[model samples]
Target: MLALTGYVDRLSAKPGGTIAFKISSTLGGEYLADLVRIRCGDPNPAGPGLKILPVDLPFGGRFRGRHQPVHLGSYGRIETPAALADVPVLTLSAVIWPTLPDGNAQAILTVGDPSGDAGIGLEIGPDGAALRLVTTGGTQTAAVGAPLTARAWYRIEATVDVAAGTARIVQTPLDPARLGLRAATTTVQVTGKPLLAGAGTMLAATPGGEGVPASRHYDGKLEAPTLVAGDLDTAGVPAGRVLAAWDLGRDIGGVRVVDIGPGGHHGVVVNLPTRGVTGARWTGREMCWRHAPKDYAAIHFHSDDLYDCGWETDFSFTVPDGMPSGLYGARLRSGEHEDIIPFYVRPTPGKTGAPVLFLASTFTYQAYANHRRGNLDEGFRARIKDWGANPNSPDDHSDYAHSTYNRHPDNSGVALSSRLRPMLTMRPGFLTFNDARGSGLRHFPADTHLLDWLEAKGIAYDILTDEDLDDEGVDLLRPYAAVLTGSHPEYHTPGTMDALETYTQEGGRLVYLGGNGFYWRIARNPDLPGVIEVRRAETGIRAWAAETGEYYHQLDGELGGLWRRNGRPPQRLAGVGFSSQGLFEGSHYRRLPAADDPAVAWIFEGVPETIIGDFGLSGGGAAGFELDRADVNLGTPPNTVVLASSEGHGPSFIPVFEDLLSHVNTLNGEPRDRLVRADMIYADLPSGGALFSVGSITFCGSLSHAGYDNPVSRILENVVRRFAAGS
Candidate 1:
C-alpha cells in the first residue's frame, strides 16, 4: 500500500498548456508538492544515481490530500426505455461463454430501476443459471441446480409472467454432445410483481445505485443479449415481440452497442471489453471480423478492466510560455513516502526549439505502465532499499491496475492499457528486474541514460512523446534534423510508424537507440484518449496471445500484431528488426570488417577498439536483453552496413519465436544460435536521410559508461553530430 501516489491527465503538453494532476494520499494530511526536471532515473549506486533538479514554480507548495478510489470492471449500460417500465411480462435471453462459472454470482443481464437491487435479471453463479426478480413487494429467484462448465457456450433464458405469478430460468448447452454437461430448468411461483420505474439495463454487472459503484462483474463472453416483451417457451425460444436486442456484432470498432430491436435501447460499453471475438455461432469459416462480423459478435468482459480512475484534480500546472521542452515531474511528498508523476513538455505546437528531438516512448510506457512481473522477490526488495529506488512495485499494488503485458484474473490477455491512473512503472528510479550485473531499469527510467549523457555532453534537444508524434504525424518530426528513440520502444501505432517512415524518407535522420522497436502494432482511438489497444495476433514474443479470429482491434478496426506481420517490418524503417531475446544479461559487440569502410568509418573515429561496449550499467554490456539484426530478406536496405555484431550471449538467450521454423532451423535458414546475435547497422537513405541503429535494448545503458567517454558513447556522439549537421 502506497502512502502517496498520483498521475497526470496527459503524458505531454506544449508550452503554455495546462496539465492536471490527480493525487491519492492515505496520509490524512497535507503533502508537499514541487516540480523537478528528471535527468537520470537509474538508481544503481555504481551508476550516475537518480539526478533530479528542482524547478521553482508558483504551484510548488503544500496541499490537502485525500484517497481517490479506483473502480475496475467492464460492462455495458443502456438507458431505460419507457416501454420496459410497464411490460406485462418479460424474458431475457443471451448466449454466454462463462470463463469463471464456478466463481461468485455474475449478472448476465439486468433491467430495473436506478438502484439495481430492484431489477428483473438473469445471473450465473456457482450453482448454475438463475432468474432474479426484485420489486416493491418482495424478491424471488429460480435457479438451475447444475453448475455451468467453464469456457462452454450456453443459451440462458429467463421469463417472468406478472399476472400469472410465475418465473422460470433455463440453461441449455450449445454443444449438447460435450461430456459432463446437460440442460437445466427451474420454475417457481412469483410472490411480487416488478416495479421498474426510471429503469436502466446492465450487462455483465449489477448496477449500483446513484453515486455507488457497480458490482458482481461477469468474466466471460456474451452474444446477442435480448429482452422480450413476453415469455420464453420450454425450448428456450422467445414467444413475444423482441423489445430490445443488443447485437454485439455491430460497430465492432467502437464503444457503441447496437440494438436491432424496435425499442431502440442502445447502450455503450464501459472500460473496454474485448470485442471482435468469436461468438457462440462462430464456425471458423472467417477469421477477420470485417469479413464476417456476425461470427465475431461476442464481447468478453473482465472484472479487472479499468479504463480510467476518474480521479479529481488536486492541482494543475500550465507550462509557462518559455518552459523548455524536457522531462518534468510533479514531486509529491508525505513525510517518509513520496511519488513523482512524470510528464513530458514539448515545444510550443508547430514550433521548433532545437535541431534534435528525443522521442520518448510514451506509448510503449503506457503499454507496460503498471506491469506486474511477479518477480519482486526478497532479493529485489533488498536492492530497492539499498539503492533508495522507487519503493512501489506493481506486484505490491494492483489498485491502479495492471498493464497490457498482464493477464486478467480469468487468464485472458489484458489487451488495452490506459494512462489515466498512477503509473508506478514509469516513475523515476523505478527498478524493473533484479539484475545481477546492472541496474534493472527498462522503459522510462532506462531511457534516461541517454538523456543524462546528452546533458553531460551539452547537446541541445527537444523532447516529445510517442503519443504526441502519433497525433501530429510527420509534421511533428519535420522540424527536427534528427530524432532519437528511447530504449525498448516496442509498442507503436500505425500513425506513429507512418510518420517516422515518412520523416526518414524525406531526408530526416533517425537514431534508433533501442532494440525490438517498431515491433508490435497498437491501435489508438481519438474518442478514447490516453488508451492504446494491442492484440497479440498470429506471432511475436508476446506475454499473452489473442484468441483465434480476434486479431483486429476493437478501437480502430485495425489488425493488431507484429509490424512484420502487417507488411511493414522494422527492418524496412530502421535497418533492423527484432531477432532474439534473453534474460537481462549482455555481451560485447565486435567491430565487423565493414567498420573499415570509408563511407562510415567516422562512426568509429575516436574509438580504436575492435571490441566495443563490454562494460556498462545495463547488464554490463551494450548488446544484451532483447536484440535485433539486419536481414535483407526482411527489408533491410541493400546499402545498409553492418558495423558490428554481438556474440557470447549466455544459454538463457534464444531466438525470437518469429524467426523459428523448427527446433533446429529458422525461417531465414540461419542456425538458431546465429540468429540470436545483435547487429549494429547503418544505412543512407535517399534525399540526404540516414539511419543508425544499435540493435539492443541496453545499448543506451552503455552511453554513460566510464563517465560518458566509452566507445559506445563516442560512436553515438559522432552519429548524432553528423546527423544534426545534415551530413
Candidate 2:
C-alpha cells in the first residue's frame, strides 16, 4: 500500500522553537501539510475517538521516498598505530560460540584493510573457520575440514607470515563431546602485494574493508580476542609480543572496551549489543555479572542490531507565537497514503498564567516504540485499516528498526532503545493491544484522551514531557500549581522522578492518573542522546530478565530495574504502587468508606453513584490492563486515604510476582484481598502539596464516556479544579 511516513527530530518544542521533520513517501506527487491539534487518538466510536482540529498553515511541499542509509550491526573496532607494512607476521586467537555460523562469513578478527591487498583476517563460514591473508605478493587462504557446530564453544587460531607467504588455521572444540577430535589445521601459500596507505585497523565481527558496506556481519558471542605480532612459537608466543588483547568483562557497567595488552588499543561497541551475557567458561557458579564478570566476558554481536537512524531534515518548522500549547503534528498526505508526525508544542518558558500541566509520558513512549508482538490477526488488521489508523508497525517496518522488546539475530534481548528513528506506534490510532471490547490505545496516543477532556472542559493547562523535566528538573514544573501524569507512565529516570517528587513536596499538586507508573528505572546515556537503556532485573512483569549482576545500569551505574526493587515504590511518590495485572479487561471502582471522610469529600462533589465508571472504553471500565494499590508495607504513606477500590475483575487478574510468596488460590481478586484491586488514593505531602492517584492506566479512557459527563469525569474534574486553585 502506498503510504507517507516520517519522523520529527524532537518530541516537544517551545513556542517559537524550531522542530525538524524527515518525511518519506511512496507517492510521486505533492503532499498536503497542516498543523493539527490532536485531542483524542483512539479511533473507536465508543469514546471521544480521533479528535483532531486542523490549524491553517501557509506551507506546502512535494515529497518522495529517497534512499536513506540505516546502519545495522554490532561490532568492535580499534585503530592501531602500526601499519600493516611494519607488521609482517600476525596471529589472532579467540573463543567463540557461533549462533548463526552458516548464515554468512563472520570475521572474527582483522588486522588490515580487506579492500586492498594488505590485510589479514580470520573468519567463520559455511565450510568452517578459515584464515585469509592479503600481502604485497598475493592472497593466501586456509580453512578447517568441517563446518563449526552452532552454539558450541571452540578455540580458534590463525597465523599469517607475510614474509614467508604462508597462512595457517587451527580449531579446537571446547565442548566435552568433541574434545577427543584432533585439532583441525589448514595452510596455503601465496607469492607479492603492495603496502596499504593507512595504519592497521583491528575489527571483530566484520572485516576492516574500505569499500564493502555490508561486510558480512557476525552473529555470535566473542570472548577475549588476542593478536600477537611474532610468528607462532612452539611454546606459544610470549606475553610481551602481544599486539592487542581485550578483556570484554572489565567494564560491563559501561561501554569502555578494555585493552589489556601493552599497546593500550582500547575500542568501543557500536549499535548497543547485548552485554553481561553468558560467555564461554561460564560454569553457572555465579549468575551475577558483578560478582563473576569473567564468566560474562562475551559480547553477543548480531547483523540486525540497530539503535539509531541518523536521517537528515526535510524541513524545519517553528511554532509561531500564540500557538496553543498542546498535542500537534505535521499532517502529511499523498495519494491514498497519509502520515502525521506527532509532536507537542509546549508553552514558552516563564510563569504563564496556566495552573495545570500535562506531563506527557515521553520516556514510556520511547521505551515501547516499534514493538512487534507478532499477534496482529486478520480481524485486527482489517479493523485498523478501516478506522484510518497508522497501520505501519515494527513487523512491517524493519527498515525503521525494532524495539527493546525485540531480540537480536542471535536471540538476545535488545536493552537499548533510541528515538532517532521513525516511531510507527506513536502516531494517532496506533493500537498496541487490539482489545476485544474497544479500541486498544497506548503510549502517546492513549494519553490524548486526557487532552481531549481538558480541552472540552476548557481547562487551561500547558504540556511538558519527561525529557523536559529531566533536562530542567523541577524548574519546569514550578510554574504550574498542579502536574498531571499520562496513561501508563511506566518508565522513568532518576532526574524525572526527582523533579516530580520534589515538585509535589514543594507544594505543587500531583494527579497520578495512571497505574504502573514510575515503575521501571531506565537510564539515558549522555554519550548517546535520544537513547534509553532498560535492564529488566528482579521481580516485575517483564518481557526478559536481566542477568544477575546486570541489574545495575551501564549508563549511570545506578541500579536498573523496578522502582519497587529500589525501595522507592510508586506508593512513596503517588500513594499507590503496582500490585496486579491481567488482560485488557476493566471493572469499575466502588467508593471506599474513606471517600466519605470529611477530608476528601469534595473529591466526589457531583458524583452520586457509589459504583463509578462501570462502563466506558478501555476494556469497559476505569481499571484495567494494569492496576496498583496502597500498601503500608511498600511505603504507602500512613496518612494516605483510599478513596475508591476497583471491583469484579475477571479470572485473568492476578497479583504481581513481588507481592506473592506462594501461588495460593486466594490471591486472585477475592474480596478484601489487598493485592487484587486498584486503590484510588489521596494524600498530603510534607509541604502544602497533595497527591490524588487513580491507580489505573485505563482511568483516563473512561473520561470521554457520555460526553465527559460521567462520574469518573466529574470526580477527576473536581480534583483538577480544586488542585489547580490551591498552593
Candidate 3:
C-alpha cells in the first residue's frame, strides 16, 4: 500500500495552480483521493519546496481536518439517480507484468463462482497482455447464501498458478471457527486487479469472459488474503464454515464488503450478470494498482504512431544519485509481465549519454583525382560522379564486385562517425536492419560484409541507407540518437529531405558530414516509378537553385528548377545557407587562411594545419562541387555560420583561377552569371543550414591521404571520435 496526501483550496485559500501527487488503485479506479495526495499552489513563485500529500487512511477530503465516515444514502429518491450510479470493481485495474518465453509457451486456467464477479486469469508478455480471462473455467462456482448472513467475519480467496496451470479457491475467517476450503479445478480463467475492503460490482459479462447474468452481490470484510495451490471447488465447501466467520468490521485498510442475494454463502453458485460498459465512473478517494504488466521492452519509434504512445510504467526502485557509467536495464513485473528500457548512466546526475553517428559516402571513398586548376573537374570524375547516385551500379551480383555506387550513401560516414553498426542483418549480407548505411544494399543479415565486421566489433549502430528511405520510409531512422552524412553526399529526393528534417527537429540529432548531400532537389511521383523531373526551370518539377531572372513558376513540379519562388531555394529563406566549392589551399591558390584558423586547431588536436598547411595536402580553391548559399531569391538569415571561404571563380580578376563569373546568356535575354555562384537549398535556410566547402579539390585528397601518422587522419579521427562521444 502506498501513502497519500490530499489538499484542495479555493482562490481565497491558495491562489494559482496546484501541485498534485499521483495515487492509483489496483482493483478498480473509481475515486481520485483513493489514489493520490497533493499540495496547493500559491502566487509567490519562489520555486516551491518538498511537500508530500497527506496519507490519512481514515480521512476523505484534503488534509484540512480529521477523518470522517464516508456514507451517503438517498435521503429520499427524488428525481436524479445520476450520482448514485458509482462503484469500484475489483480485477478491473492493475495486477500483473508479463515475460515472453525463450521459446514456445502456452497456459490454461479454470473459473468458479457462477456470479462471475470474482477474479480473472492473465497471460504475461513483454509489452501487453497476451490473454484475458476465459469464462469457461469450470461448470460449478462459489455460493453466496444464508451462511454469509449468519457469519460475523469471513474472507474468500481464489488464485491461479500459471506454472501448474491450475486455479484454487479457498475460504477463510477472521475467527478460526469459520473456515472452509475447496479443491483445485482446471479450466480457462480471467485476469483480475487487486481487491480491497469496499463496495464492489457484480460480475458483468461480455463476449469472452463476462460475469454471469445473475443480479448477485458480495458484502463482507476480507482480511489476511492469500492464494492457494490448485483450482478449488467452491460448491464443495460447507455453508456453516462460511457463515461462522463473517468479517462484520473493516479490514486492514478500513473498508466494508458483502455478497448480496442468495448468490452464494459458503457453498453456492450464482450466474454472473453483464452489460454494455461505455466508461467507468469515479466517486471519491480510491487506489489503483497494476492488474497485468506489458509485453515489449523497447519500441521501434514511428511517426505514424506518436512517441508518447509508449507505455508509462511506475518505477518501484528509485535510482541512486551516483550510478556507474554504463547501460542499465530493468524488468518491472507487477504480476507476471515486464517492460525493459535501458538507460545510459553516468557517475553524476549531470553526466550524459554519448551519441554516435556514422555517415557513409561514395564521394570520399570512391577513386577520383583532385581538380588541378581548382575550377571544375570537367573530366572522368564528373562522368562517374553520378555513378553512385544513379541506378546503374551493377544489375547483376558478384562476389568480388560490390554495387558500391548502388550501395547506401550515408553508411560509411554515419557508421564511422558514430562508431556503431547494426545488431542484426539480412541473410545474404545485402539487406541491413538497424545500420544507417547499408539499407540501400538489401544485404541479408547473414551476409558476410561490412555489416558482419560491425557486429563483430559490437559497435552500437543502425545501418540505414537513403535507398531504404525510398523503398521504405523515414521511419527507419527513428531509433537512432543522431544521423550523420559524408561530404559530397550529392543527389537527393524530396522524400529523403522530409525524413532528415523530421528526425532533426523532433529531438533527434542530424550531423551533415558531407556537404551538398541530399541537395539534388529531384521531384518524384510516388505513383509513377522512376519518372523524376530534374530541370527546375520549366514544369513537372522544380529547380531549387535557379538564377534570379530565370522566373519559373511550374518548375517545382513540371520542370523542377533549382531556384524559384514557387520552387524557391533555401538561400532565399534562411540566411547563410549551405555552400560548397573545390577551393583548397595547398601548393595551389594565392590566399589560404593565414596559418589556417587557429580556432579550429583544437579540432585538429594540437595540429593547427591539419586540413590545409605547409604539407600542402589540401590545394586551394580546387572546384566547389555542390554548395548551398544565401543569394537573391532567398538571402540567408543572420544565424548561419560561414566556416570557411575561397577566392577566385568570381567576376573580378582579384582572386584566382580565371575570374569569369557573370556572363550574359546567349540563348536567353536574361542576365546569366553573378559575382559568386551561391548554391541553394529548398526551404532549409531558416533552420540555419550549413556549408563548408573547398575551392580546391585537394580537400578530399588531404582528408583521404591522412594515413597512419598523417595529420589529416589525426584531425579526422579526433573530430570523429569527439563527434561519436557527442561532445
Candidate 4:
C-alpha cells in the first residue's frame, strides 16, 4: 500500500476550534499500516445550532479493503462525549484498495468518513469530551478534554513512555510555506487507557442533550491518516524527508519504491514495467497512470513503449510518501527512447460513466498480391484500393485504384492491358494488413461530421488504427456493445471471426451495409502472399486478364463459389442477389413489388423500405448509374436485417464475403470510414444502436459537401444512432 504523507493545516483548536497535523504511514504485512496520526478537528468551536452535517465523495461511492478484497468496505466511527454546547465533535475514517484485475496491483487510498460501518461509535453533549473504542465487541471510553471550541492545526503522537499516558497531542504542523522550522523539543502528556485523545459529548452528557440536533461538521481533504506507538516529548518529533526525480534507465522490470519510515510503506508506482514482458519481449499490453484527460500518444511512436508520472499533471501537487514534495525522478525508457517522461499522480479519484463507441473489424487487413481486372475493370483496378495510401503504395505515391474507390473516378479506374480498362500498374507492396482505422475500407476514415456528433453525445471511442490487427490475450472488440464492419470487409481470421461471431451470438448485434464482402479466402506468407479464393463460378464477377499474367491459381471447392460453401447461399444477407431492383430507376431486374421483399427491419423504422436499380450504381452496385438497378453482393449474418438494396452489377452479384482465415479452411465476415480510401463500408449494429463505417476513401469531401445536409446523411445518421443506442 502507498501511504499518503505531507504536512496538513496546523491550528491550536479542538472539538469546537481550528486544527491540523502532519501524518506518516507505512506498509505492514501487505496492508497500509498507520504510523502517525495528525489532524485539527472542529476548529470552529461550536457555540450554538450545529446539528448533523453530511459529506460524501463527489462521484457515487468507494471500495472497502486495503491491499486485498478480503473484508472490504467494513465501516465505522470516532468519538467525543459531553460535546460542550455547540463545540462540535469530529472523527476520521476511510477505505483502501488495490487496482482492478490484480496481477500488477498497487494500493490506492480513498478518503472518507465511514459513517459507522466498522465497530466504532460516537456521541457529543455538554461538559467535556470522551472517546469510545470497541474491541472484542465491547466499548472502552477515553476522556481527553473539558470542552474545546476553536480552529487550528493539532499534531497527535502516541509513543514509548509507558508510565505516562501514550497519546501526545501538539499544536505544531509542517507546511511547505513554512518548511525550515526547527523541530519541536518536548511533547505533552496524554492520559487515556489504550488509545490517545478525544472527549465525546454523549459519553459525558448527563441528560439527552446531543440528540437535539446541531450543525457543526468536518470538511476538507485530509492529507495524512496514521497511528503512532508512544510519547515523542522527550525524544523530539520526527524529521520529514523530501526527494524527487527517478530514472529507471533502459529496459527494466518490476521496479518498486517505498518510504523508509515507521510502517515501511511501499510507494505507489505510476509508470509500471511493461506487463508480461521478459527476456527482451513483451506479452501483455502497456499501461500507465496518466493524470490527464484522454490521450493516444504512445502507439507507433518511438515512445509507444514509454510512460509518464504525475497526478492530474495539469495541476501542481505535492509528492506522496516515500518521495519528496518535488518533481520525483521516475521514468521508463528503452535505449534512445524515453517512454514515460513524468509518469502520473492520480486525480482525486472520480469519473463519470459515458456511453462508449468503438470502430472495429473482426478479422481484417491483408496484403494483396494477384492483379486481374474484372470484366468490368476500369483501370489498374484493385491496385488502386485505399487510394494508394496502402503500405503497398509506390514510392511516388500515385494512387491507381478503380472507379468505385470511395466513389472517385481516378481512384476506381482499373488500368487495362492491350484490351486495357485504363492503365494497369504493378504494385507488389500493396498490403491489406494495415487495414485497421479506415484503411480496410478501400478508403480513408477521417470525418469531422461523425466525430462532432459522437462527442456531443458523450461517447468514448477506440479506433483500430490503420495497422494490422494485433490482438493479445483479450478480444478488444468484445467490450463494445456493437462491432461495426466497415465497407468491403474482405478479410477474416479465426480470432477476429471468433470474437465477432461470439459477440453477436452472445446477443450482441450485427449489420452489413456493404456489398461483395467475405467473398474470398486468403493467407499471409512472407513471400508470394495473395488471396486464395475467388467469386463463385455461378455468381462471381468475371475478370479479364490484361497484357500482364492472369491469376496463377484457380479456386476450387465450396468457398470457390458464392454460396458461402456451408449454410445457404451467401446472398441471403440481403435476401436477393444482383437481381432485385424494384426500389428505383433503370434496372436489370425490378424488386418483387412492395409486398414481396419481406426483410422489414428496425432500420426501416420511420422510413420507407425498398430496393431499386441494379446496374451501374456507382460501380460496386449503387442504383444502375444511380438508377435503381445495381445489386447487393454480401448478405446478412444471423439476426441481421436489410434496410435497403440495389441491383445491376451483373446476372450473378450474390451477397457473400469471401476473404477469411479459418480453423482449417471455411468462409465469411465483417467497420470505420473517412480519412481517405478507395473503398468504404457503413452499417448499423443490431444491438446498442451502433453504426460502423470502415474505410476513408473520399468520405471527408462527401460529408463536407453542401449536399451532405440532405436525406442520405440524415438517414445514415439515424440508422447508426437508433441501432447503437438500442433506441
Candidate 5:
C-alpha cells in the first residue's frame, strides 16, 4: 500500500503548455522530482537496454495517502429527507438481475448509513436476501431462507412497519415457471426503534455508509428502484405517495441517472458502468441498445469498474521553450518507493519542426493501456526489481480498470478504454509479459527502443502522436520530410489513416518500422477525450468477438473491427498487411534477390550482411508475434519491391484467421500461404516520396544493439538520412 505511483493531467503538451501531476502514496513523505528523457525501456542486458538521461530541472514536495479515486462500482444515489424523518412505515422495491449471487453480499437498495446502522436497506449476500432496519433503539433484521441463483432476474420487495414493529422481505423470480424456481418470503418482529431515519443517501448496488470507507458492491443490473414513505397498496401504489422512485432507464444514453420521484432526487453514475445493457425484462426483440434503450435499460455494475481518477493537482510543470520533444517523466521518490509519471512533449505549434517526425503509436498504447496479461512470475519479478523497472502494474492496481481485452463483471466485453485513470502499462519499463524467449517490452515501453536508437545515432527528430495526426491531418506531417512509426502501431482511426495517406501522397516520405499496424478501426469521441471505443466484429485476432448486429460502434456509428473490413487493408498504406502471429519468438530476415535492385540499393549502403536482425531485444530476433507480408491482392503498390523476407519461423506461427477458408497443413510457412513471411518493402510514391516498411514489430527493437553499430541500425540510419536528404 505504500507504493508510490501517480498520473499526469495530460498525455502530450506543447513546448509552452503547462501539465499537472497528481501524486499518491501511503506515507506522508518528502518526494524528489526530476525531469528525465526515457529512451530504451527494455531492461534486458542482452538488448539495447534501458537508458535514462536526467535533465537539470528538479522539484520536491510532500504528499500523503493514496489519491486514487476508488471507482470500482457504479450505483444510483438519491437523498430523501422527509421520507426517512420519522416515517411510520416505508416500502422499498426494485428489479435486480444478479450475476454473482453467491459470491458476496450486494445491496439492491440501501438507505441511511449501513456503517452507522441508521436506516433500512435491502441486500442479498452470504445470509441470503435480507432487510435490515437500524434506529435509535437498535437493529432489526428480516431474511429469506435460501440464496438466489446467479444470472436470474428477481423482483424483490421489503417493507418496514415502524408502528407494528415488524419487517417483511420477499423475493420472487421474474419467470418462476420458466426458471423452475420458487418465491421466498420472511417476516421478523423487531424490538428496536424504527431505523426509518432516511438521513443517509439512498444508494443502489452499494452500501450507503460512505461517510467512512464502505464496500459490498453489487455485481449485477438494477432497474426501477422505488421507495414509499407510508405503505398503502403493494400491487397498485399511487404515485402521489411515492417518496423517491428512480427510473434507472430514463437516461440510458447519457451519464445522468434520472429519478421520477416527487423529490426529483436524481443521481449520476460514478465509474462508467455498462449502460444500455440487457435489462430484467429483455425479450431478445431488439439486440442493439440504440434500437430499444428501454429494453436494455439496465446498467451492469462491476466491482472492478473504473473510468477516471478525479485527483486534485498536486503540482505542475511547464515545458520550457525549445525543450526537446521526446518522452519525459516526473521522477518521484519517497523513502524507498519511487515512481515515474511519463508524458510526451511535442514540437512547438506552428513550427516546421525537425526533418524526421516520429509518430508515437498513441492509439495502440491507449488500446492496450491496462492489459493484465498475468504472466509476471517470480523470475520476472526478480528481474524487474533488479533492473529497477518495476514501479506499478495493473495486477496490483485493479481500481484503475482493465484493458479492452478483458471482460466486465457481467461477462460482457469491455468495449471502451479511457486514459483518465492511471495507465500502469503505458509507463516506461512496463513489460507486457515475462517472455521466455526475449525481452518483454511491448507497446508504449517497447517503442522507446527506436527513440534510444535515434538518440544514439544523433538523429534529430520531432515526436508526434497518432492523436495529433488524427486531429491536424496531413498538416501535421507536411512540414517534416519523413514520418516514422513505432513498433506495433496496430490501432488506427479514420482521421489518422487519412492523414498518413495524404502525407505520403503529397511527397512526405514514410518509414513503417512495425508490423500488424493500421489493423483495428477504433473511435475516440471528440466530445469525450481520453477514451477510445472498439468492437471486435468480423475479427482478425481477437480475445472476444462482438455480437452479430453489433458490428457498428455506438460512439461513431462506424464499422468497428479490423481495418481490412473497412476496405483499407494495411497493405495499401504500409505496403504490408497482417498475416501470421504466434508466441513471443522471432526469426531472422534473409535478403531477397529484389534488394539488389538499383532503385533501392542505397538502403543497404553500409550493411553487407545478407541476414538482417538475427539478434534483437524482442523475441530474440526480428519478425515475431504478429507478422505482416506484402501482397499485391491487398493493395501493395505494384511498383513496390520486397527488399528482404523473414524465414525459419517455427510451426507456432500460423496465418491469421481471415486468411484461411479451411484448416490445412500447408497453412504454416507453405509457398501457398504468402502470409508467413515478413517482407521488407520499399516503393516510390508518385509524389517523389517513398515508403519503406520493416514489416515486423521486432524490427525497431534491434536498432539500438551494439551501440547502434548493428546492420539493423545501419539500415534504418541509411533510410532516415536518405529520405530526409533525398525526399
Candidate 6:
C-alpha cells in the first residue's frame, strides 16, 4: 500500500450531488485532508508549473488512516445446493482449453467445505489431469501420467465414492488425430471418510482456506461444467441424477452463470472473464456469437483480471449548493508522501452558467489508466526526482493491475478496464515519457494545458465529462453555444457519439481541439459503474489484436473496433480522423491556399507568421505524435475547407494501416509521405452551427508557448470568442 493514495467513486457530479472518496494509507498517525482546484497540473520548470489552489470547505481536517487491500483474479462461485451436501457419491466434468497446461496446479472445479481443507477437486498439473480428495484422516491424489498439450481442447472427469472409499480421474484429448494424443485414466483407493459439502463450489479457482481470498486461479477457457449426484461412468448418467449444470453460454451479456439443470444452483462471476469466446465445438461458419451462442459457449478466465478494489469509503463530500463548475481534487498528505484524487463538478442541472463547455475525455483516461510502457529507465527516474514529479509509474507497480493496452501473464490482450483503483497515470505531475525537448506529458496532465490557458484568459466556461454526457443525452449539451474537446478524446461510446453528432447538426458550434478524436468504439454497462470495455478488432494502431471470433464486446453485444470499420468514421463528426502516428517528436504546419478565402481568413487576422507553432512544450512543435486528416471518402463533408497542413515529419512517422493497401500504394491513391500529415479544417453546417478542428494531439501543448500569445492560442481564442457571441 502507498503512504497516501485514493480514488473517487465517480468522475463528475452536479451541484448538490454527493461523491465518495476511498483511501488507502499505511501511516500510523493522522493524515491531513483538504479541497483544491486544479489548474495546470504540469510541473515543468520551463512551462507554467503546477498551479493547484486551495479552497476553504467544512470537510477539510485531520483524519485517521488505514491500509486497504485490492484483490485480483476471475472465477465463478455457486452455493452448495441441498442435493450436493450429503450425496453417496459425486461426479464432476467440464470441457476446457488450457492456455497454460505446464503451469502450476489449476483448479477446474471443486466441491469443498467452508475451510477448503476438506474437498474434492478436479485440477490440471504439469503432468496431466489429477483429482485430490481431502478427508479428516489425510489427503489423497490420483493422476494421469501423460502431459496435456497447451492451447488444446480436452474433456476432464473426476469421481469420488465416499462409501466405497475410491476415486477416479480421466483426461481425453478432443482432437486425438491432430496432436497424436491418447486417453489416460487412473483410480486410487481412499482410506478416510469425506466431509459434508456445505461451503460451496468454485470454478477456475479454489477457496483460500478460512476467511481468505480465492487462490490457484486457472488461466484458460471452461465450458459446460456439470455436477452429478452419483458416481457416473463414461456411459453417461440419467437426467434425473444431475445436481447442477452451468451453461456458460447463457446470459453472454451479464455476469451471472445460468443453471439449466433441474437443480437451480446458479452462480455469479467475480471480477470479469472474457466471454463470447469460441467453445470446444466452434465451427468456422458464424463469426458473431449472437448468431450462434452454442458455438461461443466458453469463458476465458485469467489470474490477473481486476474489476474493482472494493475499498470502504474514507469520507464523502457534497458539492455546495452554488459551487462553480470546474476541476477539483481531494488533497491527501501523510508525512512526506502526498496524493490528489481529482473529480469534476458540473453546472447545476437544468441551468446554464456559461456559453462554452469543456468536454473532458474521461473514457480515454480510463482506457489508459495504468498503462505500463516499460520505458522508465535511470534517466527517467532522475528527471522525476529533479523536477519533483509524481514518483510512481505503472512499470514499478503491478499489484493494482494494468490497462487494456497491456497483456496478461499468459500474453493475451487485456480487454476490460476499471477506474476503481488508484490511477497513477491520471495524477498531477505524472510524466509518461523522458523527452529531451520538453516535459513528456500525455492524457490527464497533458490536457491541463488548455485549462491553464482558459483560466489565464479569464474565459468563463462550464465542465462535463464523457461519462456524464453519455448518461444524459444531447440535452446536457444543447444549452451550450459551443463544446470544446481535450487533447486526446479517443475512446467513446455510441451514445456519446450520437449526442455529439446531434448537437453539432442542430445548430451548435463544436471546436475539436485534439487529434485521434472518436477513433475507437467502447462499451459500458449501467450495472457496472466506472468500467469500460474495448476489443482491438481487425485494424488500427493498437497494442494488441483480438482473436478472430472474439471481436464483439460482452458488455453490450456490440461489435468493437475502430469506429471507421463500423461505418461511423471520426471525419463524419469532426471532419478529421486518425491518419499517422510516430515517436514523441513534432513538425510545423504551413498555411494552405484555402486559408486565403475571405469567409475563413478572419481566423488568421492577428497571426502574421506563415510558419507557426514551431516552438512548444510537447516535442517543441504544435503537430506531432498521433495526427488526423480530412478524407471525403470517409465521410468528411465536401464543403469542408483545409486551413493548414503539417509537414517535415521525420522518417520515424508513417501512415496508419487503414490507409495502406500495399507497401507502395495507399487506399486513396495518395503518396504515403503526403498521407502522414495533420490537416486543420473548418466546416459550416445547414444552420448557424460550425466546426473548427486542429488535427494533432500536441496542439494544446503549444497554447502556453511564448506566454500564451502564440498563433495556436490566438486562433483558438478568436474561434471561442466568436462562437460564444454567436457570430
> Which candidate would rank higher by TM-score, 3 or 6?
6
Using lDDT as the measure, name the better of candidate 2 and candidate 6.
6
Number of backbone clashes in candidate 6: 0
Q: Please estimate how well model 2 matches the true structure, expressed as its whole-model Cα lDDT.
A: 0.79
- Count clashing residue pairs in model 1: 0
**Whole-model Cα lDDT of every candidate shown, in order:** 0.89, 0.79, 0.26, 0.24, 0.77, 0.87
* Alpha-carbon TM-score of each model against the true structure: 0.97, 0.90, 0.30, 0.30, 0.89, 0.98
Q: Which residue pairs show backbone clashes in model 2? A: 136-192, 136-193, 136-194, 137-192, 137-193, 288-549, 289-549
Worst 10 residues of 5 by lDDT: 205-214
Q: On TM-score, who's better, 4 or 6?
A: 6
How well is each residue in 1-727 modelled by candidate 1, as lDDT tens digits?
4789988899888877899998889889899999999999999999998998998767658989898888889999889764574677778899999999998889999887323456777899988898777766666666888899889999998887788877878899989887457788888888766755547888998776555567789999999899888877766567898888899999877889889988778899888888889998789888788888889889999999988889899999999887889999999988998899999889977667688999999999999989999999998999999999999999999987799999999999999999998899999899998889899899999999999999998888999889988887889899899999988888999889999999999999999999999999999889888899999999899999999878888888878999999999999999999999999998899999999999999999989999998988899899999999999999999999999999989999989999998889799998889988899999999768999999999999998888899899999999999888878
How do the residues 1-727 of candidate 4 rate in per-residue lDDT, one tens digit apiece? 1132212121111122221222222322221212111110001111111111121212112112222111101011112222211111122211111111111111111111112211222221121222333323333433333222211122322222335533222223223144333223223343333221223211101111233211112111111222223223322333222111111111112223322334343333221211111111112232211211011111000000112111111112232322111101111122321111111111111221222333322222221211321222333234234243222222222222221111111111121101011111111112222221112122112122233333333344333321123232124444444444433444343334445545545545444333334443322211211112222123333231111111111111112233344343323332222211111122222223332334323333443434322221122222221110111334433333323333333343222123323433323222111100111122333533332321111122122122234223344455556555644
* Winning candidate number (lDDT): 1
lDDT of 5 by residue, 499-536 (tens): 99998888889999988999999976676667777888
Which 10-residue window of candidate 4 scores lowest in summed lDDT? Answer: 296-305
The global Cα lDDT (0 to 1) of model 3 is 0.26
Tens digits of per-residue lDDT, candidate 6, 372-420, equal 9999999999999998998878898887888989998878899999999
